[model samples]
Target: MSLEKLPPLLALVCLAVPGTALAVKPGGTLYIKAKNTHLKASSSPTADTLVVLQPGKEVTYDSREGKTPWYKVTVPVDKKGPVQGFVYQANLSVSPPSLEVTSKSPDKPLSPEAFASSGAAVKALGPGAIAYGKTLSRPDSVQQLIALESLAASIDTAQVAEYARAGGLPEVVGRPQVARRSPAKKKGGK
Candidate 1:
């Protein structure tokens, strides 16, 4: 066809296309139903506390920022009763897949008391505390505590290990070893 005819055809096609010329804004409203009464949303998935809600409750939210680009939601406690409100995020799934914790070598002996003590400490102190203690504790317990904390961090080591085995953390491989490098060589190199 001639260029003149092609221009008219192109213009018609552009007009017919929906939301093509006008870019759709990044934001949109979302409505969610509470799958579990205990479910709540947070500003962050890693938040220490959660906002609680009753089952089948609904909430609306918008994005905090484009980067985090998720709706923030809070469930009011006692829909018609007296209770404080709790917060949650939209599009965040409360349920995570299960994971299994297994040792590298099953035959290797483990200290139940030490493991128990470390676990208790981990529970009481949380992930940050356990990570700090891992540095100060003996090598054996440090390894054990790191493993335990990994389980606490997600579902279990088996799950996290899958990511690690898939080559997720190349940056962290030499982290501990870098510290143990010769002080003289380290200073000179730097």
Candidate 2:
């Protein structure tokens, strides 16, 4: 509104603008060696399936897929030969190797039947069963049991029992017995 106010406003605007002093330029290219002889172009680096890229092909890197460190690059060939492999960021950085969970103490082995059943439950219920199982396996208390019962109701009973059995519950209490005879039995039959 006034000359004095205009200088203050201009100074505020400059302060608000970040990195105004720095000359910004386009992003630069990165040169990376293939960590593996063959690398995979996945929808995301964490994807199970990988589109194979042959080793030693120098390709230009492109944008990232989210905040994940994965970089997408273009492949030179379409499914045919004289194919040049492309570059992508597979986020597979080297850190300390992961520790394997090996049983140290001699514990009783799991029954094959129980193992199979638990595996089936995991396949059927996906992450829900896994998460519920983790909660159920915690130190038992009245509240935990109540929570487990609620979670179990949301899952297939057979599957829940299977998981319970596998998780070292000596027996899954109150598992329903399979119905053998029909309710409408022959007249006078005991």
Candidate 3:
């Protein structure tokens, strides 16, 4: 009201002005990476959802300054004014969701034939099937069974193919000689 009060009031206004100006940094862009993402009232997940942000909609948000970091975002409503809330940083990304580069498999899935058992497999079962082949009486048979199991594990498809070729055995079910698929011919060209 008076000149003395005016200086104090002006000093208070000057101190308050810079803090308010620096508080809200109003412009930055980010995209929602997942569907069903919520703009929450706080950083907590249980906080009320202000809006259901769709996958591709653009949103404007302010950068927050506090111990618990959150993005204070604004999303446009249909006819009403924009809704404002915070969103967790995890659900947001700089770019729209693209197909993520996945770690490639070193090889194709193993065929069932890869672990197919040979004659050794049958003998491995013999010791476990009968009571006469107990440990005290038939240690050799038990050892033989363990040996058979080891042999069975080592017997892969390539080994079977080699055995079949050497023993003059008939071709196994999986290995069939079929013609390779040829590319389709174009209508006007070869």
Backbone Cα, N, C clashes tallied per candidate: 6, 0, 0
lDDT (10s digit) by residue, model 3, range 63-101: 763656477777774586776677666556565554322
Residue 40, model 1, lDDT: 20
lDDT of each: 0.39, 0.40, 0.54
After superposing candidate 1, which stretches have Cα over 4 Å from the reference? 1-29, 33-42, 53-55, 79-190
Q: Lowest lDDT 10-mer window, candidate 3?
A: 173-182
Between the candidate structures 1 and 3, which one is better when assessed by lDDT?
3
Name the top TM-score candidate: 3
Better of 2 and 3 by TM-score: 3
TM-score of each: 0.24, 0.24, 0.36
lDDT ranking, high to low: 3, 2, 1
Model 1 lDDT per residue over 1-190, tens place: 4668888898789889954654422233223322222222333322322333332344433334345534444434345533222233432333322222325334543333233333432443356766776677474665676676676776543454346447754111111111132233233565
| Model 2 lDDT tens row, 40-134 | 33433223222333223334455555765455554443444322222234422212122222243125433323333343323233455556656
How many clashing pairs does model 1 include? 6
Off by over 4 Å in 2: 1-32, 35-51, 78-190
Candidate numbers sorted by TM-score from highest down: 3, 1, 2
